[model samples]
Every structure is written in structure tokens, then in C-alpha cells.
Target: MPAKKNTADKKISKTVKKDIPQLYSPLLKTYFSDLTSANMIYTKIVRSPITKGRIKSLTLEDIPEGYFLFTAADFGEENYVETLDIQTEILASSEIYYKGQPIALLAGPVFTDLLDLEKNIKMEFEKDPASKIKEKEYPYAQRFIRNGKAQKPEEFTKLFSKKNYDIKGTWTSVLNAPSCNEANGAFCTFDKNILTISTPTQWPKHLQENIKRIFNLKTEEVFIRKTISSGPHTNTIWQNTVIAVMASLVAIKTGKTAQLVLSREEHFEYLIKKSPISIKIRSAVKKDGIIEAVQVLIELDSGYHNPFAAEILDRLVIAANNIYSVRNIEIIAKAYESYTPPVSFNIECIDSQAFFAIENQMQKICNVTGFLPDELRMKNFERKFSLPFTFTNEKVREAFSAIEKMYDVNRKFISYRMESKNRKIDIKNLHNFPLRGIGVACGFNGIGYFGSNIFACNQKMEATLESDGTLEIHALQPSASTLEVWKNTAAQILEIDPKQIKLNSIFDINEDLSVPENVYANVSVMTYLLKKCCQDIQSKRFRKPLPITSTKGFTSAQKKVWNKEKFSGSPFFLSSFGAVVLELEINPYTYKIYIKNVKAVLNAGKIGIPKIAENSVKLSIQHALTELVVDENLHCDQISVSFVQSDNDPTQIDGLISRILPAAFTSALSQATGHEINTIPVKPQHFFKEMISNENSVYSK
Candidate 1:
């Protein structure tokens, strides 16, 4: 780690991601398990059992001499952590919003004693039943329109009603259930007003800021040490703070170093999960296959409230009606509080369910218009995006063309359509023939934050070319692999050894190293910054003696100019386009869906490392397939990924496969089962509930 500063002066490097290997064979240290302190006491968080209620009283009994207990009553409301505004409570005060919400922290040298104390604690609650809970709809983040002049969603729908065909649908996207990974833990010692906190988290900078505010310490006083992260994009922003604060408080109160880690169960229960959204779309299309107007109602189960509700809703509208010519589109979305744990709309939140809904709707359109799925997509594909984006029409077109030529998606889709049209099932002879479906969906994910974000980002990144030709980048830690890409970017441009570029990730514990929730955003931003810095240094290398410096900064204001409601941006950065054709055969008897083949084509600018890019797409395919169906996971051998050569810098293409695969998977399912499939994660139960629900079914006919 180099010295601290994320600022890049005048010199940055050109962007290039080289194939790099990780430097590690050493024993990895667990964040908490490896932490050793003679007097450290283990801590556990006791939570609320009821979903919605007021905590009338909480009593702690037999808290022995060395044991400690802390609750919200012991702290001020101002001393809390949040995603942006206030969401998760450090400890519940009066009203409990969800089940398994933390209510108190119990700590002791003997872990078993803490557990015993928790068991002995008596609690009383005044519960509120389901009727009292309000889960209602609210306004959408923005009413976005692409490819045509903007008009009111309602008025456009009314005007188009005369000459248009209407397609309406409602689908639910459930939580992408996560397996528990031990639990979140922290070790803190308060000494000399400098609090040292060790924990595993993606957002260390945010954690430092939170601890500083809570303990009334300065920026440098609250320090964060690099502990092994549980995994990328798994740790919630608030959980780390909550756990750290509890540990820090124990240290302060006990006058000794404190250690607190949630059990596997506690960690799973307390941490925020991805938001589950339900989307309803109503579209009016012309007979010529032109989509005139669309009205969408999205209900998102955001646990309590979504601080990024507007952003999530806005992105949904763009994805649902993007890359096409839709005259007018309106989305009305709401974030409702539920009995479940809190959720997040973080960078990694792909909203596959929403994407699935839109593309599924497109395949359904193909059914009515006598056009194939890709035909309907091409009929509306934009020549050049009217909205401000980085990718070009040529690059987008090449990807589409390659996918069409390579797989002959149209021929296969048509051939499958012809073969599987109106097949009556013979229960006695179900083994004679198999059911297969072909699906295709196009996807484009824009990199970086939207104009209006949940928090005001005022992050500054600095890079200095030391007199010794040492390229030192000052910022928080990104993933090890991504950092290598950044180094290679700088090394290629600076004509310096890649090893000469060192990252000083610990300038302040709270620097946003970027969780790489969307590695494309981080890769693009840092690579661009490094490019500018290196180019500046090259101009001064001969003139100046040594140690040239470059600094770059970003403000929330830089992105605020994007008006998603109107589908416009001052300059939306980079975008990657992808087209996926998934062919699957579903078993009529067992309803098992098996992947026949998945072929994808993408244009993500340039590839510094083709194998890495290809692997990313494959992993995404596996993840999407794992989510789309519960049975017969597809092997990587069955998936083929090819890229379109682009002259521009490498942009993001990591999430393309997962983003659009759900839609295509379901589209294929729709064909195989001879049913109009709208919802994702098609499970075994769906066959019995919907397909076999009627006697006049494809399986029963």
C-alpha cells in the first residue's frame, strides 16, 4: 500500500486491462477468528422476535461482573448508521419494524455466558397485526421515454388506444436467497481517542465516517484495518457500522478492547439482502409492431424503505424500455415496508427480475405480431441512442449482427416455434417427445452512478509519479484483480514496470476502494483517471526532475444533470451491449429444464483480456441459470461467449449475461410449456400450479 490520497494530479494513464495472476499462496487470515487480544470479550446481538411492535420493556438478567449489555436507550438517535438517510438501527429503540431486528448487544469474556444472559432476558411487546401495516404505491423516480418525443404516460396510452394492441402483465421477483457465511464480526479498541476497528467489509470509508460521527472523533481518529472481507457485494453498508459501533462501545464502556461477532444465524438475519420487486407492465403497440406507449406499476419489497428507491425505479424504467423506440413510458413504483429484514439497491443489484419482465413481454409481443423475438427487437433498435451514452450504434449493431449470424437465432427460434406449436400431451406416452424453447433478449448496462444518487459523492482520487518512477495510487482497496488491471493500465502508458505501480489503499480507512459491485464502473473510472495522469506525466518526464503528480475528483453534481424521467443525461459514461439466445428442453413428466446451449454476443469496447471477459460472461450465465431454474444447472461447456471487436476503451460487460439471461430463459420456458411465461425463477411448483392447473393444458391435453 502506497501513501494515502485518491487525487490524481495532471498525469493519468491510458486504460488497458492485462491478464494478470494473483500473488498469493500464503495463509489467509480471518477478520475476526485471527484477531487475538488477551482481554477481548465476545459479543452477541439480541434481536426482536415480533415483526411490527413497540418494545414495552427489555430486561437483562444475570449479566455477571465481566459481562456487558447495551441498547438504543444507552445511545442517542443521532449516533446511528444508515445507507444514506436512517434505515437500520444500531439497536432498536421503541418500535420494531422487522423480524430478527437487533435490539441489544450482549458481551462477555465467556461467550456461553452472553448466550445464557440473552436467553434469560425478558421482553414485552405491543404487537400490531397485518391490517395496520401499510404497503401502498408511490410515484416513480422518473417517467422515462426513449426514441420519441416525451408525453404524459396516461395521455399517450389514451391516444394510442385507437390503433394499438395492448399487452399487460404482472410478475413477482423474489429474494435471491443467499447462503449464510459465518457472520459479521468486529474488534475495536478505544485508546487515546483513536478508535481502531478491524472488520471485513466492502465499504471501509463509509464505516470510518460512521464511527467518527458516532464517537465524535475526527477523520484520522477512527481507523479501519484491512481484515479479510467475507466476500464482495455481500456485506451491507449499515451492518458493518452497527457491529463496529457495538464493539467500540463495549471497548469504551469496559475500558478494555472489545470483540463482537454475530453468529452465522445472527449475521444472516441482521444483514440487509437484495430487494425483491414486483413489476406490472401495460404496453400499447401499433399493428406494425411499433410500441407506442407503456405504463408500468412496480411494487418493490424494500424491507423498510429504499433510500435509493428513485434510482432503482428510474433504472428499471430505462432497462424496461431502453434501446428501442418507445414514444412514451411511465413507471409508478413503490417501496413497501415488510416483516423481513432490510434490503438494498446497491450497485450490484442487477434487477434481473425487472429485465426479465420487459423481455418476457417482448417475446409475448412476438407471439401476437407474427414477428420473431429478435425481429421485434430489431424493428425497434435505435440507430444511435438519442440519450447521452458512450457506446456507439455501430458497436451495438455488430454485437446483434454477430449473434444473429453465429447462432441464426431467427432460424432456430422459428424452427422451434414451428415444432412446438400446439402440441397435445399424451399422459401415457409423455416419454415419446421432449419439450424445448428458444429465447433471446438484448441487454445494456450503463456504468457509474446516475445523475441524482442516494448520497452526495465528494470523493477525490490522487496519483503521484514519484521521482523514482514509482506510480503510487492513493485510494481504498478495490478487488485484487481489478487493481492489477489499473496497474497494467498505468504501466503500459507510463512505460514503467507494472510492479512499479503501488496502491496506497490506507490513506484513510474510509476511502471508497469501490466494492466493484459493478467492476465496470470502477475499472472505467480508475483506468480513465490513470490515463489522464500518465499522459500528463509523459509530457513532463523530461522537463521536470522527478515526482510529477496528478489528481482527479468527482462530485455528485457531475452526474445530477441526467434527467432519467425525460431519458436524457449531460453525459452518461460507458455502456456494454449483449444479446443472449438460450435454448432449453423441459421435461414434461418431471418438469425438469435442461440447458441445450447458451450463445451470447457482446460489444464492451476493447478487451485487454479476452479470457477474463469471456469467463465473466460464463459465470454470469451460471448464476442466471442457477436463479432462473432450480434443476439441472448448466455447465460452462454448454455456454459460448464471443465478443465484437471495438476500437474504444474497454467498458463493462461483466453482468450482461445475468442481466438478460432470465428473460431469455423464461422466454424459452414459455415456448417449451406452451404457456405465456412472465415470472422468473421458474420452479417445479409452477408446473403443477399453472401448467397442470387446467385440464386443457399442454402437459395434459
Candidate 2:
């Protein structure tokens, strides 16, 4: 029997429904059972044990009846992985480049047989003296970027020859791996003429093109079905694509469905790790506390086969003097070859290193000149944007001020500075006293792919109006649903209830509309496209047929003109400004640092849902803090974060938070300990060792 409701109860229910806004989002699921054992066979990769070597011969102890072995010789096509660059080798035919380089693929109906075969496999190699993974001499390259007219070397040397305030510092960041929750895997099946591959990736279009070329198949013959995984950056996309291609190759050869799943250990062993970066900045500041010029030398360890080294250096140059106004600056960045596999991505590699050096230098200058960091930053903050993209001064200042107030940084910095100076004066017994310090860092991140000729600049986004008067968003990729914000944005433009807007997981259109790679940029761009599409649909709904559609590319104003040769131009669509304040307590006995609180302020333009935006920022800050302080065998760590919505500013708020927090955390710990610590994933022993060594040096001096 159906339950009955009174008139008052019905009225109350209607009132509650009207008050709460409705949101429609696709399911956020990363695990999928899309392929079953009946149709799919398990495959495992056999890798070279030596980092660099020439293959002598291969031998197999025993092979099962249904198991198959495939090597580079099996596929005659050039043994290289396809991407923006054609340099990375997929399989070692004659030589191995890295330790975990794939040597062969073994597939079988029973997964146990594949594992048994891998355990019993053996190889012989002639190890090259010059090709050792740890000792290889990587090719080197250098370039300089200057804002003013070009000066001869003699003239450049003369500017720094004066008896001025000279401060020299070196910042080094260790290898920080991307924390991937889901180990990468791929599934492939081939029909009569078409091939279907399922994998978790950011660049499905690139994968499809690479497989098509390798297999000598038509464009339509290859299909890429995306799996669900968030937080894997660019390296994951490339690594997983290689696995997908290998699976497709095996399936085509044996006429059996092939699947390859990288275990967690294999994911770490096989994929690229974040290359270490070292930066040295020498500044020539006038006695009057004005910075006249800066000479910066940056060395990045680009593991062997570093195709993206130039792009990484380009981003570093932009961040070298990011927020300050320095007219005359010389930056020399070099990419050195190393034995590890090449790694490059968004925050995990580039921006974090650049900003840490820049901001740490600012704090060091303040310590020398007796000027507050905030005061010095305000004095030197660049008011107008040049060389790089344009950003309003108010946006930067707003973010800076909000963080300062939220964290009580203004008062704490002064007290901490005085305490640090006193401790340095009598450092004989410094370990007896516990210390607390606060740090602040301000900067902005570019949205979308910028300054790179290899990445797509102009991509399209689609939005449609369904027959039932509902709006549907077709995204290029899947991510955590920020669709509440999108629905509200589209509903406001369409003059309809927010519940009527829906984001679709799949659409009946061609897969050419690959938006910018970053998730935050995708959300911001999709919202803009939805607004434009809603306007078009509203104008047509009265007279035109149902199910209208509209599409748009990034605006001319949003597109950046990049110069590949000279490496100059505005390379980003827009800048998302962020300021982070880290408050920490250092343990005197154990030399451990406890992160007490993390306060951050972001100038992400005009937030739609404040709670959702706040939660998103909190999640990223937590992740960064967990990676920074919590994971390093430390105890009692806590974090808090907030965002300030700027109606006047129009920048998106995606991965900017993750980029800014590491620098702030590092700077804070450096200030507290009175050590110039310039590194990532900072360890307590680094400072503990420094303190013990410095005590002896003080007596000798």
C-alpha cells in the first residue's frame, strides 16, 4: 500500500525542495570491470635488468602450451613510442636506455603462467661503459632570457663588480614522485578491422593516433575508451599509452583479447620519476635596498631521453622573477642528462621548484636588510605585466593580504625574525630551545598548455540543449564533479532551474574536441562554452528544432603567441594567483618539524559554490601537506585552507593551490631553523646534521 501524506506535509516537502539547489553529475568511479576473463587474456611485461646495455641473447627456460612471447622483433615497425616527440623508444631492440625498459611481452590464458614465465626468463647483455644508468653523460644545453637590451658579457660583469650587497644562495629539490592511487593498466581487443583499447589517460587522442600509425590502420580503425583515474599527470598519460599500444599489438598478433595491468611496484619501477632540480641565484642589490640585477643559473637533471627538457626550462625562466619587478635579469638554465628516466609534468616538477627559489631568496634578502618580507615584497612587486602574460596588481595584492590576515602572519613574522637572529648570535646550545616560525609565498600559475609548440593551443568544447529543455555538457575528459558550479553557471545564463543542467559522461560526437590538459582549465573553459551555448540555444528555442547545439574555441585574447626559437611571448591563457602561509613547530630533541596549520588564499574569479570551492582547495592542500610534512615520519600534523572569490578577476582555480603550498612550507621551515633549506620533501636529518656541523664551525671562526 502507498503511504499517504497530509496537505501540510506535502507543502513542507515542496518548500524544502525549492530551497535546495539540485545538481546533476556523472558517477566518479575509477575501477571498472569492462573486460571479463572469458574474452581477455592476461599479459605481463619482461624488463631489462641492466640500466643501459646491448642485448647479447635471450633465453627461456620453459613455456606453457597456450602462452605467447613477443619481443621488439615481433613488431617490425620502428621501435619507438609516438607522442609530440618521436624520440622515446618503446621497446629495446638493440640497446636498453633505462633499468626498467620493456624487453618483451608475455601473454597467456592463465595469469599464473605469465607470472611463471617472467620469473624464469633470463637475458645476457654487454653493458656499455658510457650507458650506466647512474653515470651516463646526458647532453647539455643552455639559454639566457633578458628583459632589457642585450648586454655584452663585459658589460654584464661590470654591473655586478661594484661593492654592493651580494647575496648568493643555492636551492636544490630532491626527486618527488607523483602519488598515484591507481596503478596503470590497459585492455585491448581487435575485431575484423577495428581495434578497441581501454586505459586511464589524459590524452586519448594522442594515444589513438600513435596506435593507428604503429599498426598501419585507418584512423577510424582505432578506438580509445578512457578509464577513470585522477591525479596522474602528463607522465602517466604517456606511460599508460605505451602499455595500451603493446596490448593492442599482442591482441592483433594472437587474435586474442590482451590485457596488461601494472602492479603498484611496477608502476613506480617502470614510470618516470620527478627529476631533481638545483637553482643558484646571485643578486646584486644596491646599498639602498633596491635590487639592480639578478644572475640565475639553473641545472635540472633530465633523465635520459628528455624531450620535454626545453619546455620545463621555459617554465622555470618565467618563474625565476615571477612576482617582483626586476628590469635587468639574466637567467641561464641548463638541462643535464642523467641515468634515470625523463620526467616532466605540471606542479610536481616545474613551478614548485621555481617558486621555492624565488620566494626563499626574497626572505633571505629581508633577513639581511632588516625589512619585513611583506614590506619588501610590496616594494618590489611588479605592478604591470611584461614579457609574460598580463595580470592586475589588485589580484596579486588581494591574495597576499587575505593569506596574511587569515594566518596572523604579519605579527608572527616579526617576532620569529627577532628570535632567529638572537639564536644565530649564540648557537652553541641552540638545540635546547624549541622554535616556531611562519612563512608566506605569493605567485600565480598559467592555465592550459603554454609556451610549448608540442601541445595543442586551440581546442574546441561542446554544449547542447536536449529535447526536454535540459542542458548537457560534453567534456573532453572525466574528473571530480565540479558540475555544481557548472550547472549554476549555465542555469544563470539560460534562465532555467539549476537542476535542468546535466554533465554527460558520453556524447554522440567525434572525439576531436580535446580541451587543454589541466582539469581546472577544462572546467573553467567548459563553463565558458556552456554559457555561450546556452545563449545560442535561448535565441533559437522559440523557433528552431529541439536538441540544439553550440561550440567555441578559446578566445583570441585567451590564446598565447609562443615563440619556439627565442622562447618569448605570453604562453598562458590566464593566471591563477595564490598565496600560502605555513605555520610550523620544530622539535628541538628529534629535529622533526610539525605542520600546525596551513592557510591559503586564492584569487580564483567569481566562485559559483563557495563551499564546494573551499572543499576542493582543502583537499589539495591536505594532499600537498601530507606529501610534504606528514609522510616524512612526522607526527601530529594538521592543515586548514580557504579561498577568496574575486568577482573582478577571471582566472580558474584548479592545480594552482598544489603548486604554491610546497614553496610556502619549505620557506617556513627554513625560517624557523635559521638554515637556508632549499629542497622538496624536506627531511629533518638535513637540518639536524647542519646544526651539529655549524656548531663546530662557530668555534673555529
List residue ranges in candidate 2 displaced over 4 A: 1-34, 119-122, 131-143, 175-180, 347-349, 383-393, 402-408, 427-433, 477-481, 507-510, 514-521, 539-547, 560-566, 629-645, 692-701
Q: What is the C-alpha RMSD of each candidate to the true structure, in Å?
A: 8.5, 11.3
**Candidate 1 C-alpha error for residue 682, in Å:** 2.0
Query: Model 1: per-residue lDDT, tens digit, 223-317?
Result: 66646655343345546766888888777666667888776665555564565577888878788887777777777655555455566665665
Q: What lDDT is obtained when candidate 1 is compared to the true structure?
A: 0.66
Pairs with steric clashes in candidate 2? 138-337
TM-score of 1: 0.87
Name model 1 segments beyond 4 Å from true.
Answer: 1-29, 77-79, 132-154, 159-162, 175-177, 180-182, 231-235, 383-394, 425-430, 455-461, 509-521, 554-567, 688-701
What's the true lDDT of residue 260 in model 1? Answer: 81
